[model samples]
Target chain A: MKLREQLTALLTSLAGVWIMSYAWIVLKLGSIHVPDAGFLPFLCGAALAVLGVAWLLALHWTKRKEAPAEKRLWHRPLSSLLLMIAYGWAMETLGYISSTLVFVIAWQQIVEKEKWAKTLSIAVLSTLAMYALFVHLLKVPIPSEFFLR
Target chain B: MDIFSGLLDGFAIALTATNLLFCLLGAIIGTAIGVLPGLGPAATIALLLPITYVIGTPVTAIIMMAGIFYGAMYGGSTTSILLNLPGEAASVVTCIDGYQMAKKGRAGAALGIAAIGSFVAGTLAVVGLTMFAPPLAEFALDFGPPEYFALTTLGLLLAVTLSGGSIIKGLIILLFGLILAMVGLDPISGKIRFTFGSIGLQGGFDFVTLAMGVFGLGEILYNLESTMKTEIVTTKLGKVFPTLGDWADSRWAICRGSVIGFFVGIIPGGGAVISSLASYAIEKKYSQHPEEFGQGAIQGVAGPESANNAASSSSFIPLLTLGIPGNAAIAMIFAALMIQGITPGPFLVAEHPDVFWGVIASMYVGNVMLLVLNLPLVGLWVQMLRVPYGILAPVIVLFTTIGVYSTQNQVFDIYAMLFFAAVGYLMRKLDFDPAPLPLAFVLGPLVERSLRQSLLLSGGDPAIFVSRPISGILMVIFVLLIVGQTIFFLRRKWKRRCCVPVPPETEKSL
Candidate 1:
């Protein structure tokens, strides 16, 4: 836990430095009187850096304490996230209907381990429901299949 | 316009078939989400934000969103009473006595009082809003750029302090949000800042997409971590109406909660959670039988429920009058207003009276809708809890994806949503509250624009912030908050080092 906190603090400071540097070198932090676009960003970056560094120093000075490890039920969430990325990519390529049907089925079967019949019905229903709602009712321009286009 | 006249005109607008239908829809959806334990009002609103595009008119869109906002307050107590599981953070206090009431076979009474109290408080707070917002906006018309800057900055700072975490962590997140807000074309110069040459980044992050990503998808992912399912208490609801004795005990509690909630909700960082907790404390202190607080006390069920609902209504005061969001949910509405091209501020009352008053009047109708929905139709809401999260999670993901995609028809936006979803999940795991991030992000542009304008007006004089009366007072408060927090932090640290006793083994080693 302590290590994670320190690392997070370190990353934050590093990010601050990068943003500050970018604003200074590229955007040109002009005088406050004639402030440029980078002016507020620069100030925010500086403050973030200070806070991050102060946190780091404070963490360093304090005695390290250990916390109980959170039981790693992370696999399910992680797998779903990866599947979602795939779903997004597939939606663009294969189009909304096919991709959604497949994604829902995959999540219910793989992550949730549900029965096949119920999963298939839900997948089909939800996909068609969204399609009707977004494309037809609301007139949202969902991506279509390459062949259809 | 005179208050009565404005309200009459507002009723005319709100009573239209279109607005009334959507208001009912919003109420039903709001109550459903409120009954469900995991999905919150903020996430639900964020998920539905894209509907504003096709929802015909901003007035109706805002009316529905507002319904969802206060309707959640009415519905949250149902789960607290029946299940001992708070549907949202604000109802956590209700679980103590409300669940007890259920065990005593008074679930119907607890539920009844909660609904009635919420309705009363919601109506009272709406009255307060009707009276106060116009005058406040009229006064705010005198505010200059410096004052706006100070007010927004103070709002952001208050959010940071009241966000409930390490002050440093909250500040870091706040700055991070401000930086993210800078990632588009400069308002004044039209020069892009941090797009990195991507065409997609030029227009900056869509408020709807980012919100859907951070609050909607992120929350679903976090809830995905806990695989354990919650069991609903199956105690029979005898009669969904409070007795006269119960009402007599709670009448004062309801009134006191409404007043406390309304006042607290006006503060920048105060909202349903704090107000409900405060109401509970006050009710306990003043109750004739304080010992019965956590033992099925009707006052316990009534007070916090009323306060949370009242707070939900009154929190809109800041957003409507000052163009500042009081909390995360209000921030989403603030974004909705901006998306509709309606700049919410002092001029909102004068310039867009239809929207200003239409939403206010819709609350009256919506509160009644909530009361009807919550009392006799509560069993339907309980049925919602039975739907397994395994099924609900995927549907939420689909909605979030479709919602984000429908906003701009960009695959890139979907990717951005995914990215923020991951970031939000990480933030949750690390104990960093993501609430301030969106609030800061929403306020960031306003802050920067106001700050630059103020400097330009003063010819780069930083003293302009201190010279003006309103801005000066706000700045003083801002500085004191920082200094006070710093002092408190240091004193705690010093005490930890000096006063904490060491074990003999550690002392010998030293």
Candidate 2:
């Protein structure tokens, strides 16, 4: 937790530095007489950097005794996030229906450990329902990139 | 126009069969989402925004959307009472006394009072909206670019201060939002700012996608972190209706909450959660039997429930009149209206009276429908809670992905949603509030335009902000708020230093 806090502060400061550098290099900062696109970004980046430094100093001054805990790389949420990313990637390749069916079934079966029959039925039904609702009723053209083509 | 005549015209539009049906549907869906944990009105509205494209008119679409907002407030109290799981942030306070009431076999009474109080408050808030919004809009017509710049600045500042976290973190998030809003073409220059030379970035991030990601998919991801199963209380509901004595004990609290909520809702960044918290604190402070609080006090449930509902309804005032969304939910509605080619502002009432008044009138119908829908259909909502998070989470992710994709049929939006969802999750873990981010994002372009316009109007004189009366007053208030907060922070620090006993090593080091 302590390490995480320090890392957060460090990352925030780095982000601030990046913002300032980007604005200075890429965007033209107009004179104070006439502010330009980069004005707010530059000011905000400076403030963020100062705030990050202040936060770090405050943490140091508090000096609370705490130990860093073992950091778990992957948790349930991270797994879910990965699943969502995979779903997004596969949707264009496999198309909406097949991708949705596969993702939903995989989630229910593997992540949730639900019954196979229940997972398959739910995934299929939900996909069909979404198709009817979005495609038929709403007239939204979801990507049929692969299968329906 | 007279309020009565305007409202009557509104009813004429609202009472149409199609509009009424959509209003009912919105209410039902709103209650369902509100009863379920890990979903909120903002996310639900964003997820369903694509449907608004199919609606015939902006009036019907906005009526349905408005119904969902207040209806969620009405339904949020149910899970808070029955399952001790606050369906949304606004209902978190309700869990204290409401769940206790359920333990004492008064779940039905608590739910009943909550519905009644919400109905009363929502209806009264609609009346307030009808009477107040037009005049406010009329007054807002006098606002120039300088005034608007001040107003948006004040709104962002208020959101950060009231977000109830580290001010610096809130500002950082707000700046991040502003930076994100800087994506796509500069509205003024027509030059792309942060697109990194990508065609997908040219249109900027879709508002609906961002909302669905942060509030919907992000929330689901966060909830998945907790693998522990929720133990729902299986208390058999006693009376579906509150007893006459329950009403007697809570009638004043309901009224007080309604007033408090209506006023608070008008303030930018003041939404249902803040209103409910304020109402609960005020009710407890003034109650004769304060000990009854957190121990199944009927007033506790009634006050906050009513306040949140009223706040939800009244929060529409700023959005409808000033084109400023008080919170994320209203921001989604703003985006929805903009999508429909209707810009909400001082001219909304004059230009699109049907959409404005129709929505107000639908709230009256929607609130009554919610009262009927919540009381009899509460058992259904409770059954909805039985659906495991495992099944529900993936469904949410699927819906969000589908919803974002369907918006422009762009797969890039799905990727954007995932990125924001990750950002949202990280923000939660880092103790930074994401509430101000969306609000700032919504207001960012407006702030930039107004600021640039004001500067141009004044030949780059920054004093243009202070030279105008309305803008000057707003700027003064903004400065005072900052100064007051800084003084308060220093005073607290000083008090802590004076109060805490120093250890020998620390004193020696000092």
Candidate 3:
């Protein structure tokens, strides 16, 4: 918990510094009479830096106790996140229907440990329902990389 | 136009078959999600944004969306009463006395009073909105660039107060949002700013992508971290009608909660949760049997339930009248309007009265629908809660993936959504509120435009902000808020320092 808080503060401060540098180097900072593109970003970057420093100082001063860590709390979320990424990649390669089918079935069967029949039924039903809703009804024109094009 | 005639015209648009059907659909879906834990109105709206494209007209789209907003507020109390699980943040206060009422076998009475209170307060709020929004928009028309700049500044600062954690963390997230808003083209000069020569970056990050990623996918991921095992309590509900005594105990509480909720909802960053909490506290203070609070007092359920619904309704005032969303849900609505090629601002009432008034009229219709939907059909919503999160979470991800992809058909948006989803997950873990981030991002372009234009109007004199009366007053308020917060922080730190012991060496280093 302590490590996470420190990293968050440090990363935020670094982001602030990066913003300031970008504003100075890339965007134009006009005079007060005619503020340029960089003006708002510059001010925002500076404020961020000050707030980040204040947050760090406050944390040090308070010396707050770390919250009790949960065991394996991140496991499900991480796996789910990875699945989502894979699903996105698959959508580009295999198309919406195929990708969604694979993703949902994999998630239900492997990650959630559901029965095969239930998983396949749900996966097929949801993907087809979404296909009808987005494609036929909404006319969204979602890219079909593989089968349904 | 006068309020009566305008509202009549609004009702004309709102009552159309298509509009009415969509409004009903939104209400049904909203209630289902509201009764089910782990989904919020913001995420739901973000996930369903693509449906607006099929709806054809902006008026219908907004009516449906507005129905979802207040309908969720009405349904949020269901689980709180029966299972002690707050279906949404605003319903957290309801669980205290509501679940107790269920435990004591008065669940029917509690739910009954809550429905009645919510309907009354919601109707009153819509009336208030009708009376107040047009005039506020009219007054806002007098605002120049400086006034807008000041207003957005104040809005961002107020957002910090919404966070339950460190204000500094909220501010940092807000700043990050503002920077992210700087990604594409410079509005003033067509020169590209932060694109890094990427074509996708040139259009800037799509609002739908950002909203869906941060609120929808991000929230699902965050919820996945917790192994939530809810114990469902079955309480026999004989009557769906409240007793006369229940009404007698809660009538004044409902009235007081409505008034309190309305004003709080008008303030930037003030939403259902705060208003409901405040209402509960005030109701307890005024109740003759204050000791009955948290122990199944009818007034306890009535007040906060009324207050939250009222707050949800009135929170639209800022969004419709000023183009400033008070919370994440309203921010999504604001994004919806933008997608429909309508910019919500002081001119919304004057320019797009059908969309504005139609939405307001739909709230009245939607509130009545919610009363009907929540009373006898509550069993339906409760059935929705039985769907396990394992099945629900994957479906949510699938929808999010489809929603983001469907918006512009750009795979880059999918990537962007993933990125913000991770960022949002991290922010949650680090105790940083993600609410301010989206609000800041939505307001970012407006803030930049107003500030630069204000400077241009002033010929570069920063004092132009203070020279204008409205802007000057707003700036003064902003400064006072900052100073007051600083003093409060210092006093808190001092109290903590006195309580906790520090080593001499550590103290010296400090």
RMSD to truth, every model:
3.1, 3.2, 2.8
TM-score of each: 0.96, 0.95, 0.97
Docking class of 1: medium
Model 1 chain A TM-score equals: 0.87
Off by over 4 Å in 2: A62-74, A145-148, B500-510
Docking class of 3: medium
lDDT of candidate 3 over B392-473, digit per residue (tens): 8888888888888877787888999999899888877776778888899999999999998988988889999999899999
lDDT of 1 by residue, B397-478 (tens): 9988988888888889988898888988888887787778888889999999999999999999999999999999999999
Ranking 1 against 2 by lDDT, winner: 1
**Candidate 2's residue-wise lDDT over B1-510, tens digit each?**
777898999999999999999999999988988888778899889788877777889998998888888888988998899888889889999999999999998999999999999999999998999889999999999999999999998988888887667787788788888888888887776666778889999988888878888888877777777644567778888787898999999999999999999998989888899999999999999999999899999999999999998899899999989998888889889988988999989999999999888999999999989999988877888888888777777777777788788778878888899999998888877767888888888888999889878877888799999989999999999999999988887766675577975442332100
Q: Interface RMSD of the predictions, in order shown?
A: 5.1, 5.1, 4.2
Q: What share of the true interface contacts does candidate 3 keep?
A: 0.67
For residues A1-149, write the lDDT of model 2, one tens digit per residue: 44676677777788888888877777766765566777667777777787777667655555444344334333777877888889988988888888999999888866777898899888988888888877888787876759458
Q: What is the lDDT of residue B76 in candidate 1?
A: 87
